[model samples]
Target chain A: MMKDEELVIEARDLTKVFLDFWGRPKVRAVNGIHLDVRRGEIFGLLGPNGSGKSTTIKMILGLLHPTSGQLSVLGQSPRAVSVKSRMGFMPEESYLYKYLTADEILNFYANLYGMTGSAKTERVNALIEQVGLSQARDRRVGEFSKGMARRIGLAQALLNDPDLILLDEPTSGLDPIACREVKDLLLALARQGKTILICSHHLADMQDICSRVAILLQGEVCATGSVQELLSTPDTLKLTLQAPSQTTLMAVLDLLERETGTRPQVDLTGRTLESVYIETVSKRKSAS
Target chain B: MSHYFGKSLTRISALAGLTVRDAARSRLLVSLGGILIIGLIGLPLLISGDNTLTRRLQVILNYTLSFAVTMLSIVTLWTACGGVSSEIQDRRLYLVLTKPVHRYELWLGKWLGIVALNALLLTLTGFIIGIMIWHTLFTSPESETGKRQACEQFLLARQSRLPESPISEKQAQASAAALVKSGRAPAGIDAAQVATELMKELKNARFVIAPTGTVHFTTLITTPLSGINDGLLNYKIESSRPERSPIPALWEIQAAGKKAIHLSVTNYPGLPNRLLIPGAVMKNAPSLTLSYHRLDSSSSATLFMAQNGQEPELLIPSGSWAMNLGRGLLMILCRLAFLSALGLTAGCLLSTPVAVFAAFFIMVLLAMSGYVESVATSGAFYIPHEGHELSKTWLDKVILSQFKGLNRLTQPLLRLDPVPLLEEGRRISWLLTTQAVAWLVGLYTAVTALIGMILFNRRELG
Candidate 1:
């Protein structure tokens, strides 16, 4: 039983070099690295631009092969069907067929997953509703707002009910409401035991949704851990006071330094611009 | 791959249906088709009566069909290119590639849709011609004549039996029969081309028409020659009317009571005046259709099997009795089959219009340049020297063999040309529709498969 069960993906010493005309290495897009993603988890891969994140993703997808290494998905070659059948990918940019309507695009993807006839139509309708695009299901994808396009991309990604979902910058260009919706959808999917690997630079966003995170920098992972484990510093606590004066702040700072052997910073301000904006909008919405 | 294939195919099929609906809604296809229809409607107006108009219309329609088919080929080839390049350039391919679709499926599905578009265009255009043809042949006042006209064009043919043997009496008779049957002679070869084309074309010789009209009352005999220097036989004729005699040799002709037309000879075949009739007057019931074509051998234009200098299909065939539909069908078959191969091959590699244009140029170069270059560079064993016959006739066999290889390449282009193929295809009878179709399909299969492999290999998704 153990022998029959295999790792979903395995990349050993995976490295890639972008070459110029003379066959000399122009840049090392991916340095030597190794990784294996489990069958199911909301695994978060966080990185800034040019951190080899997209490169790694492309290599895993077999769009770009590793320069020197053995890389396989679902215990077969990267090009093999076993992995492709189980896989769904969302790129940093979602370039859908402009001529196709939202419903058509969803239907097309569903068909690629071998869903057809009434089943295809039903699944497509459900996806449209789930993505909050039922209202504009017939709208041409070209006319959709960026958020809507992202939602459609998300819907297509989920069409196959793929065993492994790769979502890159899923909520990169969305309004807060849309962002929250996408996050919730991902969470809901994760709850259903689907393996999802999300790549994004939004640390706070990943922190909220990811059970585990790997932070990459300069073509390498600098840190990897759960949000609480990596972020919670020990022996650090301070009281929030309304309109604390400098003298009170100084006294508290001194007390905190003496007790905790560390100087503590004070902040009298509690609400950020976003908080005020949200509250004002909520109030206006309620009034209307 | 197959699942993705089926899915992608289904999507494209739907896309094709949507395209048809959208295209209809936009009135794009309808407008173009309307223009095509209107243009055909005016074609008959430009000609004089039923028979005349049918002949004119037949030429125009055949030519129009050919041109349209070629254009459609270009369109399909171009669309294939446009689909891929546009997707990548617009960054739209990311949409499908990201899905669970294989690259091959994506390629194949798109190809299917494009070909379907081609078939639509073809059917639409062909229907217009078909309607015009039916109206001209069936509903027109001279329906029987029109059908006979088309038949005559196909049956009557002119060709030389291999030229190395001097144009013999029997061969000359056969050629005369062929020429009269087709209403004209093949183009003649000048001294310059004789040496070159002689080896290349075993049967590629020019047939000449003698000047002046023929008189039924008297016998006129003359010998035609091969080489210009062999000898010249001069002759003259007394026609039934003196006015007819003063007319130019080309335009003048004598009826039954006229004297024997004077005979002349040249370096070609010989003919007896006993069978000579008024060349123009003998054309009873407009005998057949006629077409003029320029040949490499002669300075004057040679006549092809044209019915009254127009489409042979619109004239009398084999004594004006039965309609030989096989001829027209054969021509259409050659065009469709060859063009299919060309279009499909062009479609796969060149997936865009510009790329397809490049592919056409490449294909043309492959055919023409390969032919010319080989002939130009081949080892020269026989440079002509004066009076150097030396009995080295054995070289004929080897040189002819080499020439045949070159002709094989040229044969495809020739066969694709329906009019010529239907006439001369009898000589190359072994290569028929089935073989032609196989050749075409094979070309399409190989090229399309290559295209699929390339696209699939280049594609990547997680």
Candidate 2:
């Protein structure tokens, strides 16, 4: 009896301090963090590098124990293996056993979670096809490029069809196309009612699919809310109108300024590089 | 709930599966296996005492097995190191660490994996040697051939012969008991002495002991003594196998006090003076005694005499006395366990291999230091002045000082100079048992626990 919108994660004053070999303090990697995520939501933890977003995610997953404080997932301790049996993880880096074939790596992980026999085979095969890595699944993980590795990592992370999934920098090293494919995959998983916690520095990507976002800075949550809420402020409006020549835009901005009082600026007078690039690529695809 | 998890068995089995596969694929392990077979098989064929094959088997038991343990333990370092360190290096540590698994499970799994791997390799190697030995026993190689010279002539000669099965069990037991009660054993109240006295009591017994060095030359090893001449069987140089021609003794009928002792070291001789130890003298040498005065680095000696004929080296009389193989095996396993324990502990605490290796080196040094305090302790090598009786505490400290243990066959195996246990093996299995327990349950266990704790505390996923 799984509850929809039930709290899947809860952290109370979670703190993690990294220590040196001699047990001396080195860094307070994460500090006094409090967070909760409703079940079946794509929760995004956004931050720059070393911002403790990944640390927080790991704590939620029980890959790391918090130095102080407590955390639970699905009403159970993160470290409970039984709970882990219902969880999947995608680390920031695909630190997979290189010597193992992708198939072997998947099987090893499946076995770790106690998935076995036909169920394991069926799940691994489906996930491989789903992640679009069916062709390369037999290859040694060592032979994989970073992008390919990330694809396999995603596939393995989904093997258990876990109730809670944690993805750290899931699309960090993928090509744009691959990134789009992964984004679509996350959305599809979300649509299927899987809860996901993703940690990423790519704020744009986070903003796109996340049900809610937690923006972190220096081991603390700076802001947390839905993407639209965080993006909207009384002071700024991101207006997108039909593109114009610089002269026409300037005139329009002057008129708008006269009406609105505060300075209005003519921005991106013509299609920006990203827009142009996307358009060109789409046009090529259509022509093909 | 963490206790009695069925996962320990499951994890160990999975890890063992991987471990066996890995070792089987290793070229070094395979080659090492092949060489060990050749050595074990070829060695027995090369040497045969006219009277006892048991003595020949003794050589293999004492020396070859020690070497095996050393090689196996060294192999454990790489296996154990790769078990975790390589995973971390390749960034694959995250896979297991993040699996909602207990940290201790991973550590324990890895240890079990490596040990299972080592045991497989060593046990297989041991099996091959065992089979060869089994073959050697069922069919004694031309035992009816050695020229039977007159007994009195052989007895008077300066010989270095492997022991023959002349002494009976009763004689060996009597002698071993006599040796212990008389305190004639190298160290007082030593297990070896008791065993040796018992062995001496066994006047007419035939048994094969493991590898031991013997010197039956009729002469006091040191000090000016009498009537020694050439024409006698002064020296018989043999490789690990039987030889057609005897190698000449390095020392002939030499002068007195100047000291002329033939020394051919198969491995570095144990801690003591270099002397002519023949194939017989070491034959069933009473479990060797490791005598080290704590805090004292002064040299010590072990004098083993494998009598020329009818002097049963070991008291035991088995119908099919192959050799003392299982005797030191427990000790060997214990030593390996300790080495791995130390290595694993260091590996956990320090991410750096150099740091870990350094830590391992320190552990070995400490164990060896059990012999005597290092000169690094203080400038005190020789004995104190006669009238100056040192205090109990200082003496204890000095006695417990660090030392570089004797690494005869391999490096200081026990690190704690486990000679006393060997010396007392016959009468007192306790010393050896104690050392084994200390190794298995003490250093190795403690270090393994430490390793587990460190690993459990580590944060890898982040």
Candidate 3:
């Protein structure tokens, strides 16, 4: 477990109230929320529609001003330009310059961060290749497919190699293969000691990746805990074993049923379909 | 300071490059260029010069060039407006602002990109017109004499010298006092009204010549007239006699410390006539003195040489035509830069269509700035008929007064206009170009960029 002292993000009573045209109170998008994200942690913000997940993420990214609260990323105000340089944000949509090619889009962002010369070109090419868009690098973004555009967006978010990467619905339009790639990429980045804040509704995906999470409801945190603490069934015992003979499995189930005075539910033990699919496709790719 | 500037410059350069790429790829740019090319090249094919190749060239330069400038300005404003407004609307601005770019950098970068594009387009069209004009001049069937005359008078940048400055307020006041004392003005007449009336009258007043008498006037020559002989003197002669007829006269021109020129005026109709003087006698003269003798002893006459009123002028070559054209275009570019800044500021504050409409509205107002000036200075919206005073209502007074204030605010921005000078083949003086650069491109652009940056920085992007 990472130490709690190295906090990369801190919020105290953080709130954001969206106003009407007249600037009167219209809706409370985030209400008095507190959060602490440590360095090298994969933190997830999970919620349903209108539950303030995206709004909270936007506030954290300094896109929206809080009504009343203190929020900081990298020990500085989110609005700080230098702080922004060290951070990256992938918004809910792929808001890229449609007229520019993928290569240009990455290069543009890199240059905005004051990167230039061969270093910029090399980084841009590497990003394009990493996002698996090397083939379509020259195609205009407007001509790219939704999945391809999402991939490019991810690549741009990583262009500066930011320490604090914020991804909002990062896997929304990605294919399963791309989704796995993104999840693995997040893990790899976390291993490299980068702080990641992901706002999404994919519970299974979040469970597979997030070390800690906060569930929001009606602009408030309904629950907050580590993945194990939140999802683990303390009252139940689980066993994982290789598939045995049918008789052996039946005897084990009978013993459990007799002890509990109830029927035991049995299920097949196998790899997840996603894992199997990835394995099959990768094997085929390697053979080709 | 240098380090920060260098960093800001780098970011601004990147954003400007991106903006240029976007503009180049836009279909609107291509469409505008197509229209501009058609208007520039195709219009000459459609219009006949009426007779003379000089007239044809004049029409092309006057109409086609003006049309091209207007079109380019409109397109430049449109591109500038769309460059910022469309980015905000499409949410692409979100991506950009999230980077480490300052709002000022973004604003300046957009302006620079639009300006760069305008320069390219203007240079291209200007080159085409220049080439076309030279080709037409070389290929025309006019004799060498006609060609040389046209080249000397129409194709060169000339400076105009008047007899004197216009009648000042003090002169007008003196005239008003004479009129009041002479019992011409009614008792208790409005003194301000009388002064204005006298000013207008003095502006159009004629120089009177008694029968068989001589009238002398001296003019300070500012430009050099060193070439072969030719001068145009515009005059209107009116005879005070029972039988209306042309008056004959002897024209004597005495240059400072030079041999005097004597020519006989044979025809002087009631309508204005242009007298062509022979010999380059006015050359190397610091000033010129004209003596008009009324040789027609039977009739008295009046001569009019009003300033800017079809007055007699001595046009002297001052500079090269090509350099003058370049200066004129540079002035146009300055105005375009100001317009681009205004469009960008509006775009930052409003949506695309609204910003475009506002910019166009401002352009129209600037084009009609003469009316603004009149209303502001005279407190009258429109000039009255000859010898009549305007009856202004309170509403007219209030509205015109307000417009007067606005005119005072925007006068500096609207003052320099190069089109007329270009049409007349007059030198666009360096002073005027300097004023344009100072106000239009420097002060005005900076203010506009500041306002845009403030608005954009305060804007909430989602």
Candidate 4:
């Protein structure tokens, strides 16, 4: 485990209970879940629907207070204004002011961080370009397509160049190419020693970028470890090679069965569908 | 500390700017602006006044200015209510709350935004009305006297000074006691109520002058009327007999140690008349006593003066019409500021429709506060029939108490109304404007804003 100083987010028995109007507890959205997100790591929170992923993220962002437990972000209370200054959050939906242009939205958030002058402009401009929204920066967000709005949301999240970023379903409505781009961006941010916490249902994307992951079930963490430690199969072995003739493949299978006294499963390696779709689109765009 | 405050100000200003931009781009404001322009131009053309230019100008000013203020007030309340509630309903507030901005800052920013929008719209309306008044006054084919009368009576900012009451409360109370002892007072009403009613009747009786009898009135001018060329004494007389034609009267006016100036004049009942006092007679004279003597001894008709204390006013030109109009607009702005704060507080506590409804309900309640006060003061829940009485229940008492509280809370809002003053060409004084700011904006608005900020901060935005 990393030392406490290097921990960006630390939680002990963190819990949140939603209450009805009369103050009776209605739902235990997050129950006694512990988390430690260290510096310079991509941490994934994996869960099904209603598994408390969004609830946990909201608590961490100080949008909702925890019913009981202890939580600290960057060695300060989650609600500390100074701490929020160093953190960025992207909610499940875009949730942007529909009347404001993409550029105006970014500028508004930048101002909240007390940024001004050329530095703010440069940072906003760069984030717009990075999120692939430069073409639509002047258009109102209400007029944008879902994918375009998602891109602008991401740009706003990066406006202040926050040290710790929390994203809930970051690529929820993106196309395959944009999804890949987002994953690539997460990896790049992780390499730059920035801590990132992502809550998502996209397991393939999570597997591609997350160094460590915690799986939640019914507001409880059921499993947590490094990706390799949690997913590896010690007794299973497989080999990948270039395509062989039918006769050669049969001979190899017979030899392996005779030696091990067991029949082995055979499968061919293939590229993910996401990769295939992205490649096709990229090729078409370049040709055009 | 200053740096920190400066940063906070920047954040708040940015939020306010965004709010204004949002409203500017919305269809609601655009539609309202179009409607306002149409009303300003069309309402005057639709309502043709009497052929006199002064009456025409008065009609235009009264209707157009009132329409503008009413429309703007409604818009202000609607926009402020929706600005916060809809953002929360749509989850757009999530993005803002998660930032470094405090919730109070957000609330204040929205309020300031609404107030600024109202200011802009009100300025536009005032400018258009001003142009119309100027054009009508300067270019119309009306006679010079007609135009001059319009300027003096309906355009200049004049302060009114009323005559002191001739009867005193002590004397009225003593007379009421004597009447009660003699069994001449009404039996059902309380003694205090009887004394109050008797005071009003006795004061009215003091204004009646019998045949050949003289009545005197003293007026004290607090401010020195050095530069003013003339002042006007406006009076309206009522008679016991409505059919009586022109009654001759003599007026004697005397100043401290100066020769009495006497004039013979004819008075018509139920008609308003003004006598101009020359600057020379008013120069350096702080006090004047006027004696009215009835010259018609053959007729038994008695002249009656109104007891409302509005008549027999001495009008002194205080300031220009433009300045008065500006002050009137400022008063309206103060009212809008209070409404903005009220709507914001409601929005913080309730949903959009509920907030809007609650705000409007409060406004309606304020409009009917006079009635509420009367009912509360009456101390009865239901009106009793003739010769019937109903005892009070606990619920009735509770409701009456609530109404009393509401009256007390809303009294400040209804204290200074600018529309009537502006229509009548009376001065909306700087002192009155300051009091409005104190009560409407300073006290009422600040209280609502504090409540809103507290609720908003405690609320969970997720």
* The best candidate in terms of TM-score: 4
Scanning candidate 1 chain A in windows of ten residues, the lowest lDDT window is A1-10
Badly placed stretches (over 4 Å) of model 4 are: A1-5, A244-248, A258-262, A280-288, B165-205, B211-214, B226-284, B291-303, B309-311, B378-382, B385-391
Clashing pairs in 3: none
Q: After superposition, how far is residue B195 of candidate 3 from its true place, in Å?
A: 10
Per-prediction TM-score: 0.67, 0.64, 0.88, 0.89
Put down candidate 2 lDDT per residue, A73-121, tens digits, no spaces: 8899887767877788888787776667788778777766666579989
True contacts kept of each: 0.44, 0.53, 0.63, 0.79
**What's the lDDT for residue B183 in model 4?**
82
Clashing pairs in 4: none
Query: Can you list each candidate's DockQ?
Result: 0.36, 0.38, 0.66, 0.76
Ranking by lDDT: 4, 3, 2, 1
Against the true structure, candidate 3 has what lDDT?
0.80
Chain B, TM-score, each prediction?
0.48, 0.49, 0.82, 0.84
Candidate 3 RMSD to the correct structure: 4.5
DockQ computed for model 4 against the true two-chain complex using alpha carbons = 0.76
Per-residue lDDT for B155-245 in model 1, tens only?
2321112112334445555655555456454456343344333433322222222232121111122222121111111222222222321
Taking every candidate in turn, the Cα RMSD to the unseen true structure, in Å, is 11.4, 12.8, 4.5, 4.1
lDDT value, residue A14 of candidate 4? 98
